[model samples]
Target: MTATTVRAVLFDTFGTVVDWRSGIASAFDTVAARHSSRLDSVHLADAWRRRYAPSMQRITSGDRPYTDLDTLHRENLTSVLAEFELPFETSEADVYDLVHAWHELAPWPDSVPGLHALKAQYTIGPLSNGHTALLLEMAKSAGLPWDLIIGSDLTQAYKPDPAAYLRPAAILGLAPAEVMLVAAHNDDLRAARDSGLATAFVARPLEHGSDQSIDLEAESDWDVVADDIVHLAELLHPRLAR
Candidate 1:
């Protein structure tokens, strides 16, 4: 699809627009500090994140009943805590606060400015596995500037499902070709493309952290490969402005 024909740009949250690993790790560090424990927050964060795909896969494969991101996070948190053998002295309120930490994640430095630029030309929104409330809170916290919030909650299905990509196009009152999926993950872009939507890849090589090796590069052909969101906006500005 030509840039001028696209009516909206849908983004994958998490490592795409927000730095979930760093944000969650920082929050975990605070919890560790409170407990006066020498917990390895970085390792804890990595372990927790490693659970993300498998948890979602369980839902997708019907191995486990469907659950939202918040529920999944809590379940994983319980497992992580158990594995770490950490004391369970924290109140339920504290646990809730920590779970909500995902809602307050910070955006990548280029996210805000680049989104603003793209928003000027086309509608911009998140197409994330995050629940609606979670995405809304994150948008507010990270200054995401989305024209709308679209999450897996709406379709009760996560990404890689064609429905997840197409649902947002329907919500935006546009054809699949009229929407573009901009993300850091190649799999996400492939899903969008398979659903008939245009795709843009914005690399975030450090998203998995310094020691992690996943998602180091794009694995498929995308409509565009950008260094970051700001550079993506620059690439799209001419075609979208028309």
Candidate 2:
């Protein structure tokens, strides 16, 4: 947890760095426009995200072989589409495009600036459940200045599982304690902390939506807490904040 001991700073991507809901909804709107149809984009975005954890649980539980997040998202989109019963017929290409939207998600306003600040001081990249290809595409699209990518595909594990946190630190040639995880989700931070990594909680109250009720604040006494990614950068590198 000591500042000097930390060597690399990893982040949780989806809700932490990018506004996934808004980005996904915008993508849906574009597709709906393509078909000359009306779709409840926001509702679909929320519904699709709701299935994320459960879809990963099966793989984490060893019920199924570990699958990359892109495939899982595509499969989940099928069910989400079925549940919504879209007014217009959707083709396989449309399904693929909708799933690809995750890669194009826009970062939060402070994400780029804050990440630039951190990258100047430490090795920085994403340690997310997203697979390498997806995370790489997202980083390129979002201009995330990551030094390297450590994804589930590379580790064959997902977050909350100790391996997900531990593997990345090892890959970076650092001990778990030397790698800090910065995330908006309290549970994600808790898991990182439990796996011997230092944790920083960055609040993203609107990650879900304006009415989002959960993860409004740090649920536990994490190593550091801040209002946003820029604030996290400020806390970690006080000299730069000035």
Candidate 3:
């Protein structure tokens, strides 16, 4: 939403702007069909996300050097296959296709339209952990018209890290307060706030699928809260609220 001081806004892409669960799960559709494999796509998708925290922690703890999400996703694909006792020796092409699923993510129903409305008033883009190439591909495929994409690969630091928020603002020639972070996850907003950036929390109840237990509602008194990105656009552009 538009704020008196906010000149631009950045979104947390995974859950906030796109549905990763369904996107990743559906990737297995091709995998199973092509390989005649019995794939539990939903379970595999969940299992892959379950590894997200640990994978990022490795970088955060200095146990592993910083890497792009594409690299992380590749390692995750191999790991999840092992975790699920699926055949890991499948064709490398299949592995690559599955790993590239991040580029095929579909935006929420409100995402494209809301982004259009917001972009008309304020500079809008995504600040996500996704690699630049992945974000670019998704934007092209999903019809998301972003001004630019910024995140971990740019700063070599992932979200919750102050760099993730601060570096982007600095790059934009903006003070932290001049840039707002719109995310469905509270921890993301908390980190943004802690970094001096404004925060907006939008509910993404099904982001993690049926078992989703987090970010079903706003957990903090963020600068704004809306049911979806479209509602967030309306809140920001009061003229459109009519």
What TM-score fits each model? 0.93, 0.98, 0.95
Clashing pairs in 3: 2-236
Model 2 alpha-carbon drift over 4 Å, by segment: none
With a 3 Å backbone cut-off (N, CA, C), the pairs that clash in candidate 2 are none
TM-score of 1: 0.93
Q: Taking the tens digit of each residue's C-alpha lDDT, what string does model 1 give over 110-140?
A: 9998898898988999989998999999989
Ranking of predictions according to TM-score: 2, 3, 1
- Model 3: CA > 4 A from native: 87-89
**What is the lDDT of every predicted structure here?**
0.85, 0.92, 0.87
RMSD of each: 2.1, 0.8, 1.6
* Model 2: per-residue Cα lDDT at residue 57: 89
Q: How many clashes would you count in candidate 2?
A: 0
What C-alpha lDDT does candidate 2 achieve relative to the native structure?
A: 0.92
Error of 1 at 35 (Å): 1.8
* Candidate 1 C-alpha RMSD relative to the actual structure: 2.1
Per-residue error (Å), model 1, residue 28: 0.7
* Ranking according to lDDT, highest score first: 2, 3, 1
